[model samples]
Target: MQTQLNKHDMSSIKATIPHYTDVFNLTNTSRPSETDFRADIKETMVKYVTFLRKNDAPFFLSMFPIHYVNNNSLDFDFAFMDNRSSHKVNDGNATYTNAFEFLYDSCHWALAKANATSVKIVIGAIGWPTDSYPGANVANAERFYKTFLPFIASGKGTPMRPNQTINVFLNNLSDENRLFLDLGSFQRHWGIYKFNGEPKYRIDFSGKGRDLYPSTAKGVIFMPNRWCVFNGNLDDPGKVEYMKSLACSESDCSSLDLGGSCENLTYVEKVSYAFNRYFQTKGQASQTSDDKCHMGGLGKVVPNDPSNGKCEFPVEILSAENVIEGATFGASGSSRDRVHGRMSLSAGLLALTVLWMIL
Candidate 1:
């Protein structure tokens, strides 16, 4: 039960849910508690509750605040915490302890307000990153989940709230590089699977056995096998540094930043990493400009995978045209023939359409 007010009407939202007792207003704001922000939120809450009341919806509405709780009363349902402990905590015990502690505190406060244990709890988000920055690697993520899944399944709640059933949703399903740019680059890396719907590692959601493979998305198309690399024979070696910086700025260089998997790369390798990322991300379209491939004469297109050691130079995948058409995952393929096949099919379709128009 979470959605944008602008995106979905109340009726549309209700239609999707059979019966829900909780609704969350998790709208993100920079200065979350500013006067105007509070006023707008209060108005929305009033209207939302009023609508629910008219329909006899019998629901508890939760309003998420930035730092501190606002207007604490039984009228409000509960608070929200976008708990991303894996951003810093690498130790499994610490992460589990912190997550439950956060939930316990929220539960305690909500119960105190209602003066009873009738008030319930919900964990808005809990997840780990699969790449970018220190502690964001797949191994650490797998470690965290291995410890976390079992703890929740045990039904042993935190010290403050024992044996309480709290609803928990993992932070994300797959990597979306487009969202949360204001947060660090790691924001997009917080997926159980990589961007193209491939699993990073084995995970057991059931707590039965660590045998679950990631579900891959269907109909995923990939760019060609070609990669852009730094020119080895550049007249001006100084230009190489400039091109490296420029390429990183225009594309994702989080993999080359501090604590990244590629943090130990040589000067030339760093530039190549950035150049290849940009090339792969742009779909490797047939009509792509030569200038895009040329980093001031310091870039070159190569037909080889540049992934070295633990440093992976990723090739982007083309998602289905619409977001809603997307789903959760399982295959990977990239060849010149496959890419050419795609291009040929597209061109043939276009030609057919043109002939039909002429006729």
Candidate 2:
């Protein structure tokens, strides 16, 4: 079972006789390679290296080393790195035309500094976003996936590492809203599916070169189909503007931003979009005493779909009562933490039931 350890737990595990690290240790996630190696990082590396040398156990150390111009080996058994060529599409003449070539060069560069005779490589994350940025769109995302998926499925590897089978892990399966702290808005939209379990576009995951729609998540229940809209007249837009700003501050406004899906909306529509997002994000059912949807009497709840062409005003899922299907294994946090979250939820439900019985 995978459990994300804290700093203290990590130290304890390292000090323990039998090191309880995974078979493949993916050290870095989105760290820039240009930064100087910190003392703590060097210390951790020394400990891991000593452990590896002392034991004949089969363990692999993978890291994301991007700016390794010098051929200094990291001495890891395996290397995991990301190749985001789509982000460099608008670099004018320096645009990356071929993602495969870029990935090949990156892998080769990392291999040169590996210091090991044979270091396996895993293409950690590589995908394109369809929203939340100027250049981000469905066409570009589709183009990237169509080309990259087939290339990896073909098992052609790279120019330098030809005939070798490279394991490729797609960036994400669905869009996430809460990951904005660690990732950009464009990063949230990197999934093949939208936030509501709906397929964004057709993708052939089987790698047969045929485009097919992926299966949507099952048993997902959502809150009521009501939306908070701008009740005040458009002439007096000051209050509406304030409400929009407040709503955006409290909830996700990425989908209604400058290059977002709702960017082309009118002033009224944009304000309503922001209001509805805030309403939904605050748990459409109202989880707390202060979780109110009223936007200073300027917002009204209506049972209408505010979704425009290519833009969807989402009604978030009621996930608290449901057993989240695929929330088991993730890179977010530990299983213990996840279990505790579920337990707290279960306890809340039990208390509510007991209160109802008493009444």
Candidate 3:
């Protein structure tokens, strides 16, 4: 790939090989020097490092401190870069106060063992999610980035590599509703922005300790404010359950799971959430007597918002197909065409731009 890119005058775009943090040790990640890479992984890394050096490429490493808290029962405070954490790891003269540095140096030690100490390392993906778990909330996400961004900008590097430049790319941009849930529901909620182009919380990308909301997408077209909600009727309990199951199976219902944002909602609210999700996903158009919102006479469309505290029943956005069709056929060469042309430009700008910060 490097050779082909070089031939095409694209040699400036370096090849980056991404790997998980677990490639360092099989048993534990906290102790760096006390562990060695698995035989198969070590062989692969040796070959990869050789190729990377030949092509002047960089090694991209993905680290997630949230996974340690969720999967390994690590201290919650230790995941953040704040120094007030009670949990600390003593490795020789270096005391590790945060999981980020612990994992970075762990990978550094593995690279040294592989004789790839000269190769550059880039953080390909690292960020906290805002939902789908108890620890995964807006406050925690804000707290994590508040300290982590400054630490990255500080250029303190790790115990193994001091004062070295670190390039990092945030894990994602927007929440993904249709993501696979095998790794955990949190995987779909790892976005700083909501799926509808709204900022989830305040974040200072400059790493200067500023508290302000990020820029939001402008000119986003949304569907009608009407929401499909469950009527106060419990005559047919079995049918309600079946309807909710069908709706959730066809749409996203991960937010209703334990520790999710909507976990505290009432049973009726949960059913309504599922039903509304399905209705919005199916497009809010009414066809004859049968509508998507008609859930066995238990569902109805309402103009009022059904959001309860933090649990939001979101309105779907206008489909891209409609936008393009209107732009292409509404006016051949008039103000309508110009207006839709700008809308198309805005839509193109809405394309995902991954945040990459170098420190």
Candidate 4:
């Protein structure tokens, strides 16, 4: 008699638990970025997956993201938006800029090495914070839930990983039951639930799971997390002291250039700032345009309208000011329809007003 998983047993050849792995340390890890631990685990899993698929055995794997760690330590000298950049700090942390690419490569390599088709991988943790951090307010938390959870959910099957769902897990369901968000060497507030035990109202990952138990329990939906709230103020004196060794050099401050422009995200505001010696076009203070968004590149501009779709100004002719509205994860730019964008001040005001009225 042979075990159903007998054929897939690389156990004889493979390493097992703790395995010096970040097993119990989903929020913490030996590696600072996704780079340190690459395909070793995936390659090992791939072998098992291939064996299982060939032998016709069911296999399930849980994948927790380096959600809290990036290639660089959180930089305070930089503005908030500089979170994306490609440079690396002397410390092990990867810069947020190059971090995404690193994540993509590692995941892709693992999937490929796993040579796995039948084996399923689920992204067991992920999310964004609602408040700015510290206050840990419910409204901010809820607003983030509104956007973050769904974004992770929406990113379910990447263009490459289609058919491979990275099921995110529900909040507070941490296998280790870690109530705290323990990012590697960084301060974190990454749980979706309040310290007091109330759930943020935005995401339904867990509640929906009561119905979804069978599917996810069996590996259908992937990557479900309530939220991750990391709010160490760039100005936080504590972080400066705590994360000093992880800090960048004066040459590598925030993602800003010597003149403060996003090499990739450079927009009219930065451009305008450079040329005019001030941050404005004519008399209007402009909203900084984010790199990922393109409202309508000049193609939509009419003959006299001037925006020739090249993003170059039409030479100040017959102009209404361009209101750079920042980036959105989706086209509508409406918080109601998308995930991962900042909330409007009006909405904040409305939420406050409602709270005031309710109180």
Candidate 5:
């Protein structure tokens, strides 16, 4: 890749590899000389840094203070950028008030040990999730970025490299409902905006400490404001449980887990949430013959909103078919033909689902 870039006269494009905070054994925070890269990572970094130095490239690293606090059972306040709690870390003359700076400088120490102190560092991904775990909420995410962004904008580098410019990129722009859950359910909730392109909370992206929300996407089409809820029929508890499991198996139910937004919901409410989530994702087809809300006749579509406090029962947006149809309306014949082909494929899938239900 580097050779190709150089051949194309694009040597200015730097190559970077992402790494977590555990790249080094930061046992002695007070002494940079004592810090060393992990044994297995040492050889790799030594060889990689040679190329980086030759090309004057930057080292890319990912840092998540929230993960540190959650996995290590550390104080929650320690994760905040402006934290001044009793959990402050002292590294010689430098007093680290937050985990972000501690981890940032730790990477610098590791780079220095690799004999690549000249290589600049760029933060590849850093942001907080808004659900699926304790301390992962809109308020906490907002608080984190509020201080961290300004700190980044201020150009106040870590204790190891003071007053240096650092480049960073936020992890994501919008929530991903279908994201893989290997890392944790929180991975899907890291977006600053909801899946519908609405800002989750106030954020001053300019990093000037202004209380404001980002601009929302305009002209978003949505389904009707109806929710599929579990009827108050508990005669067959086993059937109800089976229906709930089936709904969750085909849709998102992360919010029903411990520490999640809907964790405190009653059993009936939990079942309703699962059913409604599946219904919404199916384009809210309660009125159609292929109704998703019909959980063995235990579900009902209600006009009244089922949302309670932070536990929101969201309405889904218009399906992709509508968007494609609109886009191909006045397009060239070839473009319309291609879109129609895709729509036919979607229709075939729907037909298969309906046939399977009949079977």
Candidate 6:
């Protein structure tokens, strides 16, 4: 897979091996002619994926999308590369809107080119991160992953080729990763193994894995500097301790002032690194909840016990039936109560059984 830069700069690392997959590190500044870069991409396409079409040998290619940009993502398209995308990629001028635009456009262009030559290509590594970003929310993440990510894996092709699933492995969840020395591409990933390094998204393709091989080919496309650590070895206990203390607390959180320090970064940071909505929005006051009785925006939420002035979410109003039929994410907190009730009943039944045995 290629780690091509954004629309402005298209200088991709030329592939050395004809059979092996390589990373492409995308994201460049403005250019006079991005068309030339597009040409470069096409030329490479003609040489590699198309060139080896005659060979019967089975091979796989994979990639990672460090940048996944879309405000709504409903009409997201990959034609933004040269602004040939079907959607309104441009607002007014030549719009190089976000990094993910390149990815989406490049995907379409590459596949179409391959088709022109009757070349067969296997799609790989498409997914959405399931955490908050500067602008993205948990709802969007869940929607994107649960619906869109699976759509990629399901392959939106013909019914006969239903088994021919495309590959879209997620980051942070698939492999055993390590903390790098932060020597290259973009940022440093200190806790690469955020647990077992399991893939953020999992796919069950009914035993057919493009032959169904269970592994991702690459990540962040071409960004070597994306998530590597430096100097203080992560394996070092003292270093980890100092890093955590300096990074987590407010007293020594000055590291944030610097362009690249993990100071003040949270676990949530690792979950959704480049998302737009990860940071809290400006001017929006946090929900300063005092026992729920507050002005719901402009109107006052009158409490049932008016003297206490403490309002609660109308649990009785939001019944299990209401949640199941009306809620965006199926039955809300009521499921917890349902489980508790079931457990209580089961416990009572067990107690009666013991009493019967004693009698």
Query: In model 6, where do residues sit more than 4 Å from their true spots?
Result: 1-37, 56-108, 111-116, 130-140, 153-155, 158-165, 172-359
Estimate the TM-score for candidate 1.
Answer: 0.60
Rank by TM-score (best first): 3, 5, 2, 1, 6, 4
Root-mean-square deviation of every model: 11.9, 12.4, 5.8, 20.8, 9.2, 19.8
Best of the two (2, 3) by lDDT: 3
TM-score (C-alpha, index-matched) for candidate 6: 0.33
User: What are the per-residue Cα lDDT tens digits for candidate 1 across 1-359?
Assistant: 33353256653443112211122122232111111213434455445444543443333322122112222221111122224333221222333224334334433433333333343445555667655654567876676667666767777776556685555667556555556555456666666755444456777777544756645433445544577888776577778778777776666777676667788998778888888776655544324454576767777788887778888777555434422355332224532223211112323333344334323
Q: Write the per-residue lDDT of candidate 4 for residues 210-326, one digit (tens) a residue.
A: 211111111011111111111223445454333321221211112123211122333422222122211111221223553111111211111232122212221111111111333
Which ranges of candidate 5 are over 4 A from the true structure?
Answer: 26-35, 323-359
Top TM-score model: 3
Cα displacement (angstroms), candidate 5, residue 200, comes to 1.9
| Stretches of model 1 off by over 4 angstroms after superposition | 1-99, 106-119, 181-183, 233-238, 285-291, 319-359
Report the Cα lDDT for residue 288, model 6.
Answer: 61
Better of 1 and 2 by TM-score: 2
Q: Tell me the lDDT of candidate 5.
A: 0.75
Estimated TM-score for each candidate: 0.60, 0.61, 0.85, 0.32, 0.84, 0.33
**Sort order, lDDT high to low:** 5, 3, 2, 1, 4, 6
Candidate 3, 195-312: lDDT as tens digits: 5455678888888868987766545666566788999689999999999999998888888987798999989999999988888777665465659988888889998878787787
Off by over 4 Å in 4: 1-46, 55-105, 127-144, 151-156, 162-166, 173-190, 195-197, 204-359
Lowest lDDT sum, 10 consecutive residues, model 5, at 335-344
Candidate 4 lDDT for residue 260 = 17
